[model samples]
Target chain A: MRTLKFLLQKEFKQIFRSKSIIFSIVFAPIIQLILMPLAANYEVKNIYVAFVDHDHSSYSQKLINRVYSSIYFKAAPYSASYDDAMHLIEQNKADIIVEIPQGFEDNLVRESHDKLYLAVNAINGTKAGVGSGYLGSIIRDFNQDIQLQWKQPGHFAEAQTIDVVTNNWYNPYMSYFLFMVPGLMVSLLTGIGAFSASLNIVREKEIGTIEQINVTPIRKYHFLLGKLIPYWCLGMIVFTIGMLVSRLIYGIVPVGSIPLLYGFLAVYLLTLLGAGLLISTYSDTQQQAVSVAFFFVLIFNFISGIFTPIDSMPEWAKVLAYISPISHFAQVMRMVVLKGSGWSDVLPHLGAVFALGVVLNTWAVLNYRKTT
Target chain B: MAAITLDNIVKTYGEKDQKVLAVDQASFAVEEGEMFGLIGPDGAGKTTIFRILTTLLLPDSGTASVAGYDTAADYTQIRNCVGYMPGRFSLYQDLTVEENLKFFATIFNTTIEENYHLIKDIYVQIEPFKDRRAGKLSGGMKQKLALCCALIHKPTVLFLDEPTTGVDVVSRVEFWDMLKRLKAQGITILVSTPYMDEAVLCDRIALIQSGKILSVDTPANTVKKYPTKLYAAKASDMHQLLKDIRSYPGVASCFTFGESLHFTFRQDDAQNIAGLKATLDSGNYLDLVINEIQPNIEDYFIQISEPVHA
Candidate 1:
């Protein structure tokens, strides 16, 4: 314990002494936390749309009003010809085009049927897909209204009585920042924790100071802990800063316990910092450690569903995602903070994280042999 | 009683075809409170031997002990008592000199204050620049700082591998002065240097070549071991003097020694300097001057060593 205290003191001093390391540890995450959530918005809006109307009827006008009124789209001026509307798509000014037939209202009135055409820009396929889906839903709602208005009072038919209502839980407005900021916090913490711990030993390796340390009476576990605990402390600080920023700037206060979030974080940082030390143990140089760390960090972030939902991934990928440490933390972060889940709800994930921490830190300590 | 003992320690690295026997059946012992040197050039396994003694590298066979503790089994005890300064400068370069010393001191569960008297002679020289980063210091200052850190723990046994390899002559002298003072403190110091002149400073040295000890004796004893009478000869044509004297059938061995050639005679040849001068004078050499002089450690090392495999 005495040895570890001195080692930790030296580590903290070195970490705080370097201008670049100080920047990376304390300030970099805060800046990323503040900016990344704002920039990484997933909700697509203001999709440009142009209309080609052959029908000047009130039905076509109502459809135009509905399309213009929805926040998902912006209405472009009516094109004089189909060629002009096609020009909007060619120039990238329009994301979608709607064409109504000349007798769209008459056809709906007399024949009770009409055909409409939609030309969607397939570029940026997510925007195209969601835009067309939203437009389809609006036209469907319009059709239902017309059918109800056309029904006479005497000819009413019996219908099913079940009323279906959907509620988006936790995030009623589907605010992307609330869901994204917590996960981003996990990513930045892992990057800083693992990279710093891995590079710390390897930096000593490069500078040749590890040889001096290796010859000392300090135990391997003491050395590993000494090298790791500083980064773990830094990881916690970054995590706290992220949580506060989430609450203050983004209004993303956790509904669950803050202490519980920190508790899982302690275990999670150990797992990450242990993995980093393991990399340092095998690597002879700092460059090797960093590259290997980069490789793992990339894979861990991807499988943890930083950009995609893990549930939507293929079966094998979802299985792989379950073993990823961050996924467990992300689960806890989203569940506890977003859903106000208690200890019983996060118990399984905490257990898995604790087990991973034990196994990984054990492997790291074992691999770090004092005698070569 | 010996403070360190290496008994037939052999260490090899790599696989079948690429194997290298880094330390080969090396055996030696340093008496308590003695100054011992492992004198050899790079790749002569000096660093390897130091690593083994410091409990940082295991020998492939045999056993070694430091301060009466078995390196393999009682390494904890050995590590606590020994201070190791590696072949490379191993202090944190980003840290200041004082910080580096304090850190090493703290690791041994001691403070710089506890051992100030031990390292004062060397630390005082570098203490003026205590805030300077270790990497930014001159080679000599860095050497002093490394020695200070190694000494800060007040170790019973000090292992310095190539401590003066890149140091300036003045710092090298200063460093040896510090080591002498440390030896006076009853610390058994084992220092290694490739330079032959540094060998004379040790109480005893193991002359190693190619991972094998060629000779182990006091500096004077090794020089006295030079079998035949040796002469330092010079000629106006110094270049031709070497080649011509070497080809003289009576010459046993010939090598350039500091602006002159030192050579001895074959077993059945004339031992007189006059006769040898006659032979060299006949060879197209100029202004031949021969002086019978004592051999130094470098001359002794050169004449005594043979290729290990041979």
Candidate 2:
């Protein structure tokens, strides 16, 4: 116990003394927390829609005005021919092209039908999908507006029309930032915990200081605990900074118990830091540790549904996602903060993280042999 | 009982077709409170022996013990009783000297104040700069700090591997003097150095080469064990002199030591020396001088490690 105290003291001193470590520990996460949400936005806006209007009718001009007036789209320069609009799409100046057929107003008024052509870039699949969806909704609204003028309100009521109202339950405003902030916090904490812990141990190996420690009577657990506790504290500090940044910048206050959140975090950080130590035990150099860590971090972020929903992934990927601790933490963070969930709600996540912590730290201790 | 002992310890690195033998059947023992040295050049398996006895490495075959505890089985006990300073500077360079010392002392479950007397003589020199980071210290100062940290625990056995390899001459002399003082305190010291002169300072040294112990004895006895009478000769053209002396049929081996050529005869006879002088004289060597001088540890090391047969 006394040995562990001294080792922790030495580790903390080294951590504070290194300027790069201090930057990475205290400020890097906060900066990433503030910057990443603003940049990694899933809500695609400012979609450029070019129009090819051959009808020369007032209804066609009104449809063009409605599409441009919506916040999600911007109006590209008017094209006289469909071939001219194709040039706009090819030049990357327009994301989607809407072409109205000849006699659009006459067809809609007399025949009560009209055809419209939509050409989407489809290069950026997400942007293209969302853009085309928005355009389809806007055209449907225009068709309804013309029909209401032609028929009385009570005439459609007799035909039995169903009215659908949508309520975004957890995120009422449908703010992507609210949905992203919780997951981003998990990613930041994971990054700070795993990379720092692994690199710190590998640094000692590179410098040969571990040889001196190995020669002493220091128990393996004492040595590993000494490494773990300091980084664990640093991870907590980074986590707090992320919380404060989310509150101050995004006005996101956790509805769940803050202490409960920290309770989950404490266990989660241990699991993450244990994984870092395990990597360090297997690696002899910091370069190897960082590369291995990069591989894991990349996989964790992508599959953990930090940027994409886990349900949308294939069955094999969803199974892998459940195995990752990040997914559970992100889920708990959203549930507790957004839905005001209590301890019983987050118990499963806490239990899984604790189990992973035990497995990882045990493997780390076994691999970290004093004699070889 | 021996303070440290290795019985036919064999350690190899790598696997299968590329197995490199680091220490091949190496066996030696250090009696309690004796200053012993493993004298050899780099890659001569000196560090490997130190690592094995320090419990940082395990031997593939045979057994080793430290302070009456087996290195492989009772490592925890061996680790507690032994102090090891590896060939590389192994302390935290970012840590202050005092912090590094205190850390090592605490890990050994002792306080610096408790072992103050053990490291006092060496620690006092570095105490003034205790607040400075170890990496900022000069090479000699770093070595002194490393020694102080190793001694802070007051272990019964101390293993120092090439502690003076990069130190200055004056500091190296001082280091040996400090070792003498440590010996007075009854601490068994097992040190290794590539410098032949340092071998003379040890009470007994095992001359090692290519994972083999060539000889183990007192430096003076090892010199006495030289197979033939050795002569040091120098002339105006020293390179040519070495060639001529080696070409002589009576000459066993010739090597350039500094500016002179030290050679031995196949037959240690006055007649053989006369024949060599005649041959050099016939070659019209100018400013030629030769003398039968007392052999040192280096001369014995060179003669015994030579591949040529007498």
Candidate 3:
């Protein structure tokens, strides 16, 4: 225990002395918290669209008015030909284009059938898919209006009784920032904890200070725990600052107990610190540690659903996400903040992260050599 | 009494085909309270031996003990009772000098004040920079601080591996002086250095090469055992003088030292100063001079390292 205390003190002194570490620890969370929420919105709005209308009749004009009425699309100048609309899409001036045939209005009125062509850029496949769905809904509403106008001359229509209700469970307004910011916070904290801890140890090795410590009577486990504890505490502090910023900037507060949120965060930080220890044990230089940490954090963040919903991912990818601690912690953070979940709701995530922390820490301790 | 003992200690890294014999089957012992030195060049396995004795590494096949405790079986006890300063300056550089000293002391379950006398001679030199970050310290000051940290616990035995490699001449003198003071306290010290001059400072020295002990004895005894007639000869054209001496029939060994060619000859050779002068004069050598010279530790080492004939 005394050995651990000394190691911890030494590590803390090193981290606090460096200006870069101070900046990364105290200011990174605030900056990320303020900027990420604004930039990382998932809601797609004001989609620019163009129309290639060959039909120049009043019926075609009604169809154009229906597209313009919905807030989803902002219609650009009408294209004289399909080539013009294609040019607009290629130049990124518009995201979607609609083409109406030469006899579309006459065909719809006389033959009672016409097909409309919708061309969507699928580079950002999610937004393109959503935009297409919104366009289809608007066209359906216009078709129903035409049907109602044609059938109600002087005939009495039968009235049917129907009840409809809707409820958005966790997020009533479906604000993407509220859901995404908490998860992004977890990712940032993990990156900071793991990278900094590993870099500290590896830096000592590179500079030859590790040789001085290796000769000391301090036990291996004590030395490792010493390095781990400081970063663990730092991780928690960053996590708290992230929460405060979420509340202040985005007006999002934890619906569950704050203590419960912190408790899970503590275990998750241990997992990250343990991961740092494991990297430090294997790497011989600070550069190697930094690069390896970059790879791990990158893959972990991508699969943790920080940028996309896990449910939207393929089944195999979802299975991979189950093994990621970030995925588990992010889910727990969202559940507690957004859903007001209790122990029963978060128990599974806590179990996985704790178990991962124990295993990784054991490996780190075992691999660490006192003599080399 | 033996404070530390190694019985045919061997350490081989890697497997069969690719194995490197870092420390071959070597054995030696240090008497209690004696300053033992291992002198060798780099890659001669000086560090491997220190690591094994410090219990940071285990020998593949041998029995060793430190202060009467088995190195493998009683490692924790051995660790607690020994002080080790590795080849590199491996300390928490981010910590201040005072904090680093305090930290090492705490690791041993002791306080710096409790063992002040042990490190007082070295620590006092750098105490003014107590609050300065260790990384920002000068090489000499850093060495002093490292020595202080190693000695804080006042262990029964101390291991220092190349403690003065990159240090300046002044600090090297001061460091050896501190070591002599520590030895007066009846603590067994084992230090390794590639600097042959330091061999004289140790009570006894072991000359090692290629992971093998070549010779181990007091410095005086090792030099006295050198069994060759050595001479230093030079000329205005010293390079040509060396070539001429090597071609002489009775010359045993010839190598150029600073401004002279140090040569050895068979004691029973008929060649005298006149014969050598005749050879150099015939070769058109200028300002020819020759003098009998006493051998130092380096000469003794060179003599022993030369391949023997059947």
**Best by lDDT, which number?**
2
Per-residue lDDT over B1-310 for candidate 3, one digit per residue giving the tens place of the 0 to 100 score: 6999988999999878999999888899999999999998899999999889988788999988999998888888888889888877777777789988998898788999999999988888899999998889999998888888888888999999999999999889989999999999999999999998999999999998888898999999999988977788978887778878888877778887767888888663546555876877777765778888888888888788766311
Candidate 1, A1-372: lDDT as tens digits: 788888888888888888988889778988999999878877789998898889999999999999889999998766967789989989988989998889999989887679899999998888998999999989987886776677667655622234467899998988898889999998888889889989989988888888899888888888888888888888888888888888899899899999999988998999999899899999999899999999988888888987789989999988878888988998789998889999999899988888888888889988998899
**Considering every candidate listed, which one attains the maximal DockQ?**
2
Between candidates 1 and 2, the DockQ winner: 2
In model 2, the runs with Cα more than 4 Å from the true position are A152-154, A157-160, B308-310
TM-score-sorted candidate list, best first: 2, 3, 1
Classified by CAPRI criteria, candidate 3 counts as: medium
Clashing pairs in 3: A209-B90, A209-B91, A212-B90
DockQ of each: 0.76, 0.91, 0.61
Docking quality level of the chain pair in candidate 2: high
Task: List pairs with backbone clashes in candidate 1.
Answer: none
Name every residue pair that clashes in candidate 2.
none
Which candidate should be chosen as best, given TM-score against the real structure? Answer: 2
Query: Any runs in candidate 3 off by more than 4 Å, and if so which?
Result: A69-71, A107-113, A153-166, A312-315, B267-274, B308-310
